[model samples]
Target: MYQYSPFDRQFVQLRAQQFRDQLERWERGELTDEQLLPLRLQNGWYVQRYAPMARIAVPYGEISSEQLRMLAHIAREYDRPDQALLDSAQQTQDVLQASQPGLTLAAPPLKYGYGHFTTRTNVQFNWIPLSKAADVMDLLASVGMHGIQTSGNAIRNITCEALEGIAPDGIVDTRPFAEIMRQWSTLHPEFAFLPRKFKIAFNGSEEDRAATGWYDIGVQAVKNDAGELGFAVKVGGGMGRTPIIGSVVREFLPWNQLLNYTEAVIRAYNLYGRRDNKYKARIKIIVKAEGQQFIDQIEAEYRAIVEQDGAPHTISQAELDRVQASFVVPPLAAANLPSKTDTQSKPYQRWLAQNVRAHQRPELRVVTLSFKRVGWAPGDADADTLDALAQLADTFSAGEARLTHEQNLALPWVHASDLPALYEQAKALGLVQPNIGLLTDMIACPGGDFCALANARAIPIAAALTELYQDIDEVTDLGPIDLHISGCINSCGHHHSGHIGILGVDKDGKEWYQITLGGSDGSALSGAALPGKVVGPSFSAAEVPGVVEAVLTTYRDLRTSQAEHFVDTLRRVGHDPFKAAANGARLDAGHRTRQAAETASA
Candidate 1:
């Protein structure tokens, strides 16, 4: 469903008539909120403490059933999950009911999950205002969509593997090289102002699932040696407050010099990276201060700007067959299998054996739609369950929807007999609770309520430790937990690869936490042990799930049973009894198991 080009309809209708004449000169004050705040942040707007948020740009996490009915028509005409936005880093205090003292707490609707960080493809408008934010950018540029470069420091949103090109175990078809690096990095008039936001990913599986060692520039799609198809790249990956990964500097790279080797690795970090540290200006800290043969001789002088054929629109095999014929896929009429009555046939085959995934077309089905359900709020999801997942993507997807960088939500194709009516409309929009890939399916980030840089309050410490693991049969009876959370160190809540990690800090401001062990993502054993760091503010937020059940009761007393899970019992007991169970001392010995379950079942 990726149509639109005549240069993407004249750069989104001339950037929506130049943001409708800068929204009529910022409503007649002759345009000034710091000169229309970078022209309403290049049309994604923002000014939100309660109003004006506007986001819109869904580039790689595709969409369309007419852009999910224009985002359920802009959150049913200007949002209302109780009109939140007072710097929404997800604060609480609103819950009231005493006979509707003008009811305000979270209404059973308008939850709004489906939002991953900026790698293009957005949808965040929390209560917009400011003269109707350019009539919502002229109704998202009449549906083709806009919200250019998503945020400042340009070139974000080129992510891949939202089951890219229907992954039946992919190796290439990263949605036509993620739409030729999203049309050669949209808004590219000399890489449009860069020094911070860059992110790029491609990973055509062997199961890297596009975390591609956290990105800045990470690819993988291999083949070469005349089997043609190229790229292995991986230059200096990222995540905030220093989280490196990406290293390999091109183990293949042939396919038509993939845009002159990514414009010679972003013009060697746009003429030698680092612009006086705004958080060590990422190009992955200029490829960790230029090593690896000086960034492979600066990508061999940008692959000699693609062997002198010049870089202006280079990766063309007829523009990857006209953007892979607008992502082909669209032919699935011949239904009539509906009859899953046995309590929907064993949780629909155990939630499709943990959220489906086998499409390269064979009657499709890639699905995911998880949002880590423990005790809720892993990634919220409300607003008539996001317009009933936009009308269940027009009856069990193919009308398309995709979004996930672990925040989960993707119906890439679906058809295995409409996976039991999309698992009863995603369990009535509590979004299929299989706890995909496990560890309560986490990946926290919006730490301290509306982060202006957090220090505690990563959503009530990830909702008081998912209500201390609120017994969903003891979280699938403890299996694949990855649980992450961040408030500081800007890892946006990836709290460093979580096998069971959590971090939040600020002793003076009152609140502190840290823990790590056997972290992961993929490509078989990534990494994370960290450990050393833990302070307290009465270790608040209901003592973080009893300090993660005292590091799962010192991983069930150094596992030898319960068939080891918590990252294989924190890799066979290390880190000083999982750092004395996240530093609060064996949570008073598992709270003396509330008097030994009433003295061993009496």
Candidate 2:
């Protein structure tokens, strides 16, 4: 649980009071909604289709237990107070309500309600009324917390692998680095107002759990010649209107110079990044527009910044040591459980293979709580399930909970012996699905349902595809593959990075989708495929699985059996066959189709 500093606390109260006064003026018919909107939004407030929803930037997915309890407390007060069960929307609203403070606004004029939940390290909430926003800010300040640079053109959040400290295989514990960056970037005067939002991610795992490549600046934990821990810095990657993987600028970087390097990169972006073209606004475009070679030269220009000035790096080594000390690993007993009778049970072995990870210490195991069960939504976790997971973390995993970027939970430090009982409890709560990297563990965003920008619904499409892959055991046996679905051109679901990506489109109000293949998830990427025309939803569902099957079938025959796999075979033969399967014939070559097209047109 992260404790906020007094400065952080006061900042929260100040922002809340500011918004509260703005709300009062709007209600008195003195301000237009458009004029009042941005002012209200500066402090995590937004008016949505149904009601207002607030988004707080949760830098590094680090929230205190007290803060979480406060979130639950706020929700219970909002809707169904007597029932003790607030509906999802209303609950989210209360958590999002901007903290209110000094502003003299009539609290009675505003009826406030809010709720809190994490969606990819961003704290999302259905927000309360604007009038009482100040009081909420006061409460948050008392707890040593505030919401700054959570929105607008600023450093949104510094994210890391959710299992940072818990996972044994991770290269470094990212919490220290995350906290350092968080403090460094919080309201940095010069870099505060940029052309657009900026996000950073850090990961040490080989699995790329932090989605390193999909950030403005992604830092992956790596070791140099000295065998000391540091990060391989990646620059200019992002998602949304334009998608590109952050290219690695440095093969190796020393640990102490992280903040310095980060400042240089941001400063470079601040100076050269586009202000003219909003579509081409991100640092990715700057990297692309300036050319990677030229970008490298520009980075060289800022070597002085890295060596000397910019981002004075407020946090020191001793400070970093103190911060690292704060993240206390859960205390687990030394005894190991008997492997047989425990892991050998029916679902036990499967669960162990899929959900469990070894810890840095020998006696404990890290449990990856998968959200993808057969019937339920992929990332959906009910209150009971959440509470149950919290209890399991306390029981088997040294009383600690880790939230993953994949929108799942991790009960780190679980004893191997206790896995059977823990599995049973989790299965009852619908959290124990023995699939971690399989196709069913797909990343699909809330498309048309919750997001106003969505062109088509992505959730149902992903679920249907999951069902298809489930229906075919052969396809399921094709090893791990990423199937991501985004509802619109923005690619909010990260479809570009998926091995097989689906982007839903609206063609005259009917649902349609386009498929893109070979796009990678990690840093080095396979470029996006040429998407086919808008195929209606009817063909989308039926043809999607069929295309996958056809591709697999071709892979089996053309391959040196299953050992060659899908990606390797695709790399060898190219996308002609897949295009033929998804689209129709006449796609071979001009020599073969030379006469055919003339006759069709004639």
Candidate 3:
């Protein structure tokens, strides 16, 4: 993990104090709600459906145990909704359930005192009181963490591959470059407020684990023919109402000129990106509408920036070395020999095969702690869980953990020999679920329950599916499936990229879900990155589990063999059979609902 320099420490502390002053002013009526809106947003405070939600940035997904502990502290001390507020919220939800006939509302009661790991490698708190926001910020700054640039129509948290420095197949460690970009973009006055939120991702490996194709700007580390390091810059990729894969603006941009080239791209977008309508403000819209003209504009802007601007932002070798030094691997102590009994255990073997991954060093391993278990929302960690994770990191991972883009934590420094001990500890903490890429390891957002923009709740659907697939044998037999759920078209859960995407929708005041098939996040398993195709009309909420079961059953039956994956099987055999299976399940569920209603009446 990158150590915070004195300046970095001072900067965050000062920023926290400034926010406190701003907040105080707002409370005193010196600033109106409209006046405080942008200020609060830049500080990562959002007024959600019922309370303030705070998003804390974890740059490039690198986090230290100390930071994790601070986050835990924040969750424990401040992330609480009043009892009255909770009751009122529950009443509203109950009313909603009553309004929708035949739809089973299994959503758990509202929760707080927890942090949610987001797909962008940030942590979110849903029920933090607005009055204590400053105090939380101060605590975060004490641990070299903050919510800067986490929200607003500006460059959000810069993300990289979770296995950036440790991946066995990594070409170049993109962490140093990503950190440099993060520093440059934070509080950048020139592009503070773009037409819409812009996201950038860095992928250094041969595989796109960072989902670069779904970002506003995707920077893939590449080596030119001459063996010089550079980047393959892709722009205008995003997932929302308009899902478009990024276009390669520059096939090879010199590594030194990364900042310069990036500025040009954003500059071009800022000048022409839509502002009148929020829906079409994303860079993808401009890219889609203009096509070659957008590319030409970026190129022209780049030329001017380099030739006329003297390429002021070019990365210097000394600067690169300074940033790279912080990412040096920690010295490892000699590891204890594994116990024969532990190594022979089937549970240990299953965990090794599922949650543990190969590291660059043969003596090391990257272990993912599963947060997608039964009875909890995906990516959610309570205060106790967060504190325990910190202790685990301190014990086995050189005090560092990486927040993965898949909403999980990765112990990147776990020694190969320490796997058994770490597994035992994590299992005791309920973090050792052997389902890393299985169907139950799904990604979902805090839907209508927390987000005002959502049309329906996502947690109940996720919980139902998780319960349905609790059998590890069944899940493992199903193979690696990317099941993603979102509450709305915003795609916060990255539903557009899931192999089986479940999007919550509203139809005539009732909750419905639309199922899509064959999407990919650009992984080896998921082939080229593309949005999933919708199978049919949205189904009632009660029918979602059956609908999914039908799709998976169809997959199992039609697949060439057990070795065939769901997405591959879907592509091999057209969507007709699976679509029909889903619709049939919906019909069956409706019939069951009608029968139960009639019985009750009788």
Candidate 4:
């Protein structure tokens, strides 16, 4: 919720105009594709399988109602693919499905006119025309939003925990620091074109809701024994072709020297980080290969930056105060009133239990509006939904909402007394599913359906599972489970951190999925940050839902109590039973396919 200064506003507008000129030149053939490529990428434009995609940064996941409305406008007006293009894309998908017969793939028709909420808290548009890219950028700039540095091998958007300021167990609100870092790194000439794309995340709470361990740089706010504010800086953590937990470089870096320390870390990586191969370009590779040497190099870089460079980036207390001012809790009419949850409706009770979380202010609550539902890709919101969300934010959440890393919207300012009314409105908008961390609340990416890099379609598998798990009681009984699906090894869906991870893979030109078990995002439910282990060979698209069901069934049977979560039960008992269940389901699916084939022949 950091307010853009006059300079910030002017800068964004100029950048948008600059992009418009670049786009016009490219259209006129004045610039080659090679020339326009980096320009467009730096502006967050990417040519995907079917159309151009735009990634708009929502810094630290904070977005205003006005910005949300602008996004809704962009989705409705600009995010459209040509009819012929849509038809061709659909044909390609149909052919892919036909290639694998006897598979019950839930190939929903490709969709547009919506925005996808990403794990990094950025919003993506799948079918925006390259021609309108400039126009979209202009509109975003008008609302203090832009796609700058959202792509390319630059430091991407800085992210923080959605509950940063309001989490009961928060050590310090990391938003101000994250914002400061964002401003410094936005267009830093030295690090703009690093060896590879870099991501940074911050978490202030006792729990790791931001998945900081899965980022290039993970910063956690901490205090020294003397109670002075600082940060616990971890470097080299990332997920993709390689999954590695970040190593703690500096256990306690003074808050004032955050930027100086961050510069040291990246500067060291820039000097020695691999550039010859994109595969090993991530800082994790350098850290993994060199270990202590890498840490020592960062230390040496820090010394040089401090001693030789004079630590030019040290934060001033006044600047910190200015940034913190924007994040203060908005004055609420019901702040002094006690929460009244006397409504006895079962649905309301369920929603309260699942979607509503305790706030730092006892009179308020943090409510998560579920985007995971049947017949839609998870985290996708059409124009109408986006507009409605904006209205909801205005009416109930002090005109602000935080986009969660899990691809949902968290209204952090919802009054405890307004829960019932808010629930009713959200339900009418189809955003009131009582499934926050449940199995149905899975995270998935726009897989082969849109992403050219995907090995298989992720949407169909997510759809199949969502359709299969419509029973709320069954989902709640199964308990909190992180079921993440990724189309490829990009880890866009953060599958490596799920308790049950499904990754789309290619086998002999047909779509197959690899199932992984026992991953964690280092949250209270999921202990420690680690990638899930693959149970067995990849299963066909048809077997995924059944395979997942089989695993859940095994979990239900083996769990000592309902309180025992999926990850916990899996760890206590072991992966053999879950692995057997998954393989058995695959065998059953094969038998069904054979039976259907015989019947067709007859």
Please provide, for model 2 over 217-266, each residue's C-alpha lDDT reduced to its tens digit, 9 standing for 90 to 100. Answer: 88888977778877888888887666777788887877777877777777
What is the TM-score of candidate 3? 0.98
Rank order (by TM-score, best first): 3, 4, 2, 1
Model 1 bad stretches (over 4 Å): 1-174, 179-213, 216-235, 239-258, 261-263, 266-300, 303-309, 340-411, 415-439, 442-482, 485-546, 549-582, 585-587, 590-602
- Report the poorest 10 consecutive residues by lDDT, candidate 3: 333-342
- TM-scores for all predictions: 0.33, 0.79, 0.98, 0.98
Instruction: Quote the lDDT for 355 in model 2.
Output: 74
Clashing pairs in model 4, backbone N/Cα/C closer than 3 A: none
User: Model 4 TM-score?
Assistant: 0.98
After superposition, candidate 3 runs with Cα above 4 Å error: 98-105, 334-341
Superpose all Cα atoms of candidate 4 onto the true structure and report the RMSD in Å to 1 decimal.
1.9
Best of the two (2, 3) by TM-score: 3
lDDT of each: 0.66, 0.63, 0.90, 0.90
lDDT: worst 10-residue window of model 4: 333-342
Tens digit per residue, CA lDDT, model 3, 1-602:
78779999999999999999999999999999999999999999999999999999999999988988998898898988999998989998787667656555366777789999999999999889999998999999898899999999999999999999789889899999998998998889877989999999999998989889899999998988889999999998998888899988889988999999899988999899888999999999999999999889988998999899899999999999999998878777644644433777777888899999999999889999999967689999999999999998888888899998789899998888788888878888888889999898899999988899998888888988888888888999999999999999999999999999999888987778899999998888999889999999998778899999999999999988899999889999889999999999989998998899899999
